[model samples]
Target: MFTARRLSMVAAITAFALMAGCASQNPYDPNTQAPAEGGVSKTAKYGALGALAGAVAGAAIDHNNRGKGALIGAAAVGAAAAGYGYYADKQEAELRRQMEGTGVQVERQGDDIKLIMPGNITFATDSANIAPSFYTPLNNLANSFKQFNQNSIEIIGYTDSTGSRQHNMDLSQRRAQSVATYLTSQGVDGGRVSTRGMGPDQPVASNGTADGRAQNRRVEVNLRALPGAQGATSTVQ
Candidate 1:
């Protein structure tokens, strides 16, 4: 008898086939709807097929992890943190434009931008190595950071709570380190970048389901303001 993991793997393969069929009949849509009055209009910057394909670590898409959706269009910059906000906004716009149709989402969180890379595509089956297919996306991201050349970069790695703590945590650390290494290799300042591994911690979805597990195994790149620099691009390492 096939285990749940095996069953989920089969299901994922099916989803890919179905997705291809769907794409053949229709273009990938972000499925954006008009914003409510005085509210942000949610726009999914990533392509539908890619996102579906990426998240299906071997199961259907987990809607619960997608969040309320991304805020579309340029957000108004406030007076208090106008400089940081504007900088972040421009970076966000550039990232979204660059990563369009890549199944990678660029979202705004207050004064920062969160680049969410689905783990299914990012790493392969408990491996810390970044998949070849994922390199282009990371390269594009590195280029964007180079262009912006400001703010601190924090790469956080996550994993589903399946394996032992030591093993999972080690895997997470290596994954985060791998991303940081890639960015610095692309000429992003090393000192401005840091890596953290949060294995099985702060899960965005339940671990009971395969879809949720796939969603939980993710890497988040957070761009934040440099301490005391007040959003200035300080050359560090």
Candidate 2:
């Protein structure tokens, strides 16, 4: 009788362990391979945590009321963050495709892509206006960028040391604005574009030789998806 009772208890314990294992299944385990859609897995995790925290906080604040409102708010915040992350991923992919095959060098810096352009394709010497021949290329770029729904573009103009500091600064600002205008005209949303002139502040090459100066007098186009822009706390290094 004693042996039979011990066996029954052991069997019950084993069943309970199996049930617990089944109940605790983690859907978002990283070891489980993700789907081919390239979704933002991290965002989903963050969103779940955010929602849980929100619900708890909400419930704590309103002890008289049930935790329903808190749970809803938390879920909303999580969903919003996840949605933004997905949008950012899509924009990044589209930008990569559009800039590919073009002569421009595209570098992925965090959540933004930087297009480094030499002076030859962007502007003429001591000129703030873009050359007429560059219109087609610029237009193509703008059109390609239109695929991104929530991204911002920044045009940064630079110059060599051939002129006064103030003069260089002014020229650089105008040049940056010119590029921004061209982009806006080519279907890119005007509100999503910004311009800055670095003058001789950030040079890619030495300013001692003609070639280096030419390289220095260039424009850089920086494109960042909205989520990245929002999360970015510091200037580009």
Candidate 3:
């Protein structure tokens, strides 16, 4: 009787161990650390961690091939970040090339890029309508944006201090909308574009001199990649 009881207790313990093993076999939690294959930076590391977490969650929700799914998701996220960094660098270089001597200032703040255009190119005096000559440059820009399909474009118009504040504001808003419309017509996704007018509120140059007025009466185009489309690269212009 004693030996039989001992044997029964051993069997119970074995069964419990097996059950625990099966219960703990979580495919999504591979505990696999991302290997530093290359010179990965802190930004890349954080991005990878976030991607891994997202992948694990997604795989768990799917309830199918969770381990494989998580791995693939993490890898994709890492690759995308690396690709975006490379693409952004290339784009900055290309922008410098195209904007050289154009008198337009290009600035990148965080993920946003700004292109400032002189008013003479965008509109005629006191007119909200964009100039015919301006279409070429704008078209070229639109073409460049086609490659970066996931980015949004914002057009902002401004005017000199020649007109009433209200009038200038209205004209500027119209001008901005016009540019947005033109970009949409040029094959840019309308959903990814917006427009606004600053009137004379934001002036990069003085409104006193002819040249300064010309500069003040201008438009600005801001570009930023939409969420989930980061690291994707395109050659539009």
10 residues in a row with least lDDT, candidate 3: 26-35
Q: Quote model 1's TM-score.
A: 0.64
Per-residue accuracy of model 2 over 69-101 as CA lDDT, tens digit each: 454556555455444444444454554555555
- Model 1 clash pairs are none
Give every collision pair in model 2. none
Q: Which runs in model 3 stand beyond 4 Å of their true positions?
A: 1-78, 231-237
**RMSD per prediction, one decimal?**
20.3, 11.3, 13.6
129-199 in candidate 1: lDDT tens per residue? 99987899999988988887678899999999998988889999999999999989999889899999999
Off by over 4 Å in 1: 1-81, 228-237
Error of 3 at 236 (Å): 9.5
Alpha-carbon lDDT, every model: 0.64, 0.63, 0.65
Give the candidate order by descending TM-score.
1, 3, 2
Candidate 3 lDDT, tens digit per residue, 1-237?
Answer: 224543344334334433432342221112321223243322344445545554555455545555555545555554454444434444544565566555666765545568888977778999977787687777767776776665678888999999799999999999999888888888988898988989998787888899999999999988876777576533433
